[model samples]
Target: MGLGLRWYHFALWAGFILVMALMPEFVSKGTLRTMIFANFLAIFAISWDVLSGRTGYISFGHPFLIGIGAYTTAILTKRFDVPVEYAIPAAIAMTMVGGTIMFLPALRIKGSYFALVSLAFMELIYQLVQVIRPDLTGGTRGMSGIVTLTRGAANGYYLSFSLMIIVALSMWLLMRTRLGTALSAIAMNEESVKGSGLSPTKLKLFAFMTSAFVAGLGGAFYVHYLGSIAPRALFDINFVFTIIVATLIGGASTIVGPMFGAFFLTFLLEYLRPFLPGAERYLIYGAIALLLYMYQPKGLYHIFMSQLDRFKKSGDDD
Candidate 1:
């Protein structure tokens, strides 16, 4: 069943895209801008899900990979005068290489130790970018006036939305393959996977690379979208917290879950702006997220599936 595909899956995805594509027509430009952020967040959340969510690795420093991509492109475009077309691809490659180098060592450990090592990697990069080459990295202040992919809220929303959909669809398809199952099995029981004659190391390497690819893609595009990059903003704990929370709240081990979770978290924050227009909004936002997570640890995805199943069963009874 892991490899199986159903008509309803395609139908559901199509319906969702249709609805989202129509959003620009009805919502205000400010709301569209907010959605652009949501689209990017979804991309980041999905990247996190691919590695930590599926493999049980639980990386606390995903932004480390993201920062690599952002900095690579920013430096290339701003300092070296490289064309964006070349710079973005270079950014992705650099991020993958960086992620592999940083994460390969930590793979030897497990659980909280692995998490700490990843966090350390993030902190390491954070300090390195600021001190190693201030001119290239723009030091702590970061680089601005980077190339932007689109203009106007409407155009930005479409670009971001398109990228988010492509990433979501690609990942959803990938996770249905045999390799995905192997990676997932590693999460459930590493020893058992080894016993089954699969090399857990190779599987993990593949998963890590895949996650880094997505992170790099998202990070590169994200910086381009914003036309700037700051070390503090990219490497901050709050940023890490948001990405992990969105993935968990949406449902781990599922692609669509994180996408919806990103939108949900973004909109929730926007909705609270009027009432608590400061840091206080985060308090209430975090509380609501905590409550939802507590009530449905499996995430909104499971709740939705349960309701669908229940409705099907009721129709059969009738």
Candidate 2:
């Protein structure tokens, strides 16, 4: 069954909004800067969870779709002299089309085959971008001095958080509808869903498109926020791992899990930065992530849920 929002959900969100609104009052700029990364990570993770996490169709090439959005916007605004407003929407449309192309294979295959193909797609995009047009793509160095959405960390934090909140709530609410149930049903048993007279292909396409939309939105804004875009950074495997790990460690198939997971993973990285600076940091971060994954594969959200269940049971017994 699809998850339903409860009264507590409203209260929880309201409290979250209040806290976010007040965050700058107490935290240092450095922390807020870290938070801005977390917010963007959350967005990327949510984009990931929408298709791969929920539908059980793991997309190793999610960064591919995101790259489409980021590159489209970057190229449009930088080389073509297009305005930011138009570039962003154009990026979204491009991603949707890219997603459809990616989704086509799903109609025929899945699992390892699909995963490998998606990885190839990402590599294909990465190679093509650098070689296709050195003049526009800036060759190996990547394009810099792009337009920025916000000036300082504080404004950036607010902007990112607002988008995060909107995406989280919107996706969460959408998943509560019947469409969510159908998508999950497809994930669980596509054959069964088909037998039930539902069109699995159509449902899967919708999920793909939805994931693309979020990826595009996040990527377009993320590039603008950073004021730069690069093929190597956008298509890197580490970026893919981070998104997958955040979603898995946050509790896949749950909207809140990815968001929470993104922040948790980001802070973990920040905390370990001192002890393990530079590329060495991922070693400790990877180890901690593996331990957490082993300890609670269902993620922090599942742990909280199990504890909550036990508490309720104990109260009833009492």
Candidate 3:
């Protein structure tokens, strides 16, 4: 059943990708810009899913890891005048270091306590970025005119879309492996995984490191795409909320779910602009999200699978 379902999912994704590849032909340039943001959001959301969603680590400070990557590359390229090619990899390395720092807390903390610690880490970075090195970090204003990896809307769209697809496909394949099952097992019960002769610590370290790598890669590339970065933008609670919400609403622990969530939330926000056009729109959006999450905590993925099962069963019965 799992194998059959996997094939079905794979085919569906293939078709979806074909459609997405052709989307630029139909949509306006502004919509393509929005898609670029959605792609990055999906990357960050998927990165969060690998650790928090799969392992049940519930990291609220994921942006901290992402910020470390973004800032590392930003400072390296902006101040030191390093080439983006070298700086991007350095940024990813910095995020790994930051992830290791986070892993230390994960050793002692779990659940809500762990979440609080992550949040604190994010807040710490937020403050430090503003105060500690105003000269290099650019203080509150942040560095601008950093760099662009591509020119024009179509090129930018393709760059982001290709990155998103590669990350999504890579993560999707990884999660299908035994390691993925083991990590998910850790989420269910760490003690059980240990009793089964696998070190939970090692599995978790792997998860954290991998998660940080993707987040960092996405953050670094995203910065270059925008050619700018700010402390507030990188470390914002709202930003964290968006990543988490996208993952949850689309279905946590499922790579495709977060991508769907990113696009869904992005388009929803765009659709609402004509109606609400202000902060209050989010109030409505939040209410809908809260209700859906409470009703189906597993998210739209489960809902989708359930419906598909029903359809198949009905066909079999007929």
Candidate 4:
């Protein structure tokens, strides 16, 4: 359960934070806003990576967990007049409970079956919110004018980036521990993990809970940042696709990969806006993501590391 961290790990993290902290001085406000989305997207992407990416769970209904957090906080803050501090924690707790419920299906099903069940859960919740209690849930139209956490783009960017970094660093350290190795083992071979005397059930539960925790935190903060929530938007398949694609395209099992992937995808879409300016922009974005994933299935992180290693070897030869 030791961290197993190296000196370079801390150095690299410090360098990245320093660079990002100085970005506002160099970038425009519009770019700062774009970065804010990237930050939150990174958080969601990491959450997915922790569960599906690590455990081979392949959650098609991750939006189910995220929506729980978002809707929970939204209702608590708007309908009940709950403080943001209290509401966010409640949202996270509710999400973990939702995650635990989702785990029940995993006990009997897996692979595509498990994925389908997760998707069903997402759809079920989507329909429930609209029909069950429109007054508090905001129904189909959704809720707006919710309390915002930050005042402007710069502040929003800082707050989001800080949260993303904290999550990334924490997850990184956690995954470096024996529990992380156990979860990854479950992804590779549940039977083997069982043979080794580790309980696959408990490992899967840990992964689910961890994923839900991060998803809740991200979803809660994301709604506050936008000061709104919509059922369609929160539970959209496109949103789920973006999150999964970001994780895979960035490199799944590794945390830093998803974070970088989120930024890459966000900026790519932002730069494509002037040229495409419509939903069609996603077509080009998807094409590029496909090409990059095909080129380096291990993701940009692995590609970068491989190149760095090659350079060092070449210098040694010289």
Candidate 5:
């Protein structure tokens, strides 16, 4: 059964890679640019999934970790003239360390209180970025003139797409392990995991660190790709909403679900832009999200899985 599961997983990803590889031949440059954003968004959403979706930790402040990565790399490369190669790795490590520190409060708190603490962390960072070390942070204007990883839509698309696929595949594999089961078990009931003699503290710490690592990696790479960083953009609640909603709408607990959700949300928003052309579009989008979330909190992935099951059953009968 394990072998079969591995085969199924490998086949799905292999097919996805084949399709992504071929997509450039048929799509326009403009569409490819949008797809690149989708890829980055998917990576970030998957990062969120490792902890919040899997362990029920519900981090409202993941942007805090992401910001740490972006800011660290940006500050190092811009102010210190550190090489990009070393700075990016340092950024990721900093994000994990910062995340572990932030998560210390969650060790003592749970549920709503934990969520609030995370939210506060994001706000705190936002304020600090504006006031602290205006020279290094570039003040309210933030940093521009940063280096981009690739030029043109095609190269950018492939880079982001490859990164997203690698991150998603690796995360999917991790979640299939016993550690994954233990994390999920803690999500279901922390007390129960403790009763089983497995420390929930240790498991939660593992989940937070893993989530931070992914978020940091995605965030650091993203800043370099865009070649810019700003506090308002990185630390916004709307950004948080998009990440969380994408994960939830895609089917929170599964890695693939958030990837699906990110693409779907990206395309949906892009399609709406021409029609509404303003902030009002978000109102409509938010409404749809709320309605769907209220009705089927499990998300589109759950619906897709159910439909697939029904189709398989009908085919078997025939």
Candidate 6:
């Protein structure tokens, strides 16, 4: 399918970019830092959605995949003396390879079995990095002095935000194409998609590869930006929960939803910091998430559309 870009899409994205570019003038450095995390989270959430969200495969092992990208680039740059340009792409390639290995199990298994296998993959990585090559992997302490792409929070914010926009815009446009329609159709009914003569295996593999590409790109850049990597933190279940909750709360199977969810969740945590400055905050946070999921399982994006449609119908009636 052609671009099918509309005037409203241009207007909306332009307005968003303009506001984000101007945000440094209004928000505190702390908020900027928070937004930076949100940007990365959006990238990760988008990665999750393209495969698991859109294709009916729930992957609980994203951090495992992301960690591969992060660790790969970090090792190449730190241990092998590779340039940033080459290191990043190499890391992405490794991630795709890792993703292919990850996808092999998916061909045979699905549903919770698929999710459990994915989780096991991540846990296996966590243990392997520490034991296999502690020198390169940095083991329990992890690696440092890695090259950083940006210096300050301001610069970091700009870099991350720009990357987020690029990935979001590209993925959104891609999903608007006929290939996107086929992928979503698989999610709805794989049997029907096969009947239509589309190979579900190929489509799923493509989706996994795309997701791996994103995870690799985002993970590689994130490590360089942070100038470090730690296995325990990267492979943690809490991190996976954050990603899944962000995607679910934002709206699964939609690019824009995850972007919004990341910001909203990040800001919500920020606001709660003063009242609950410790891990206890997650109790309240998780409660809110549960309530929202219970009420509107489709997430905030669906709610927005519902309201917009109601407004339109009201105007028509009037």
Ten residues in sequence with the least summed lDDT for candidate 5: 1-10
List candidate 4 stretches off by more than 4 Å.
Answer: 315-318
What is the C-alpha local distance difference test score of each model? 0.91, 0.90, 0.90, 0.93, 0.89, 0.91
Which tens-of-lDDT digit does each residue in 47-72 have in candidate 3?
A: 99999999999989999999988888
- Which residue window of length 10 is worst by lDDT in model 3? 1-10
lDDT of 6 by residue, 1-318 (tens): 687887978999999999999998898898899999999999999999898889988899998779999999999999999999999999999999989989999888888999999999999999999999899999988899999999888999999999999999999899889888888998799889999999999999999999999999999989998998988789999889888888899998888888898888888888999999998877887998899999999999899889988998999999
- Position 273, candidate 2: lDDT: 86
Prediction 3 TM-score vs. true? 0.95
Go through the candidates in order and give the C-alpha RMSD of each one to the true structure: 1.3, 1.7, 1.9, 1.1, 1.5, 1.3
TM-score of each: 0.97, 0.96, 0.95, 0.97, 0.96, 0.96
What lDDT tens digits, residue by residue, belong to model 1 across residues 111-156?
9889898999899999999999899999999989998989999999
What TM-score quantifies how close candidate 6 is to the native fold? 0.96
Q: For candidate 2, write residues 181-229 as lDDT tens digits.
A: 8888877998999999999999999999999999999999999999998
Candidate 2 segments whose C-alpha is farther than 4 A from its true place: 1-3, 314-318
Using lDDT as the measure, the top candidate is 4
State the weakest 10-residue window (summed lDDT) of model 4: 1-10
Candidate no. 2 TM-score: 0.96
How many residue-pair clashes does candidate 3 contain?
0
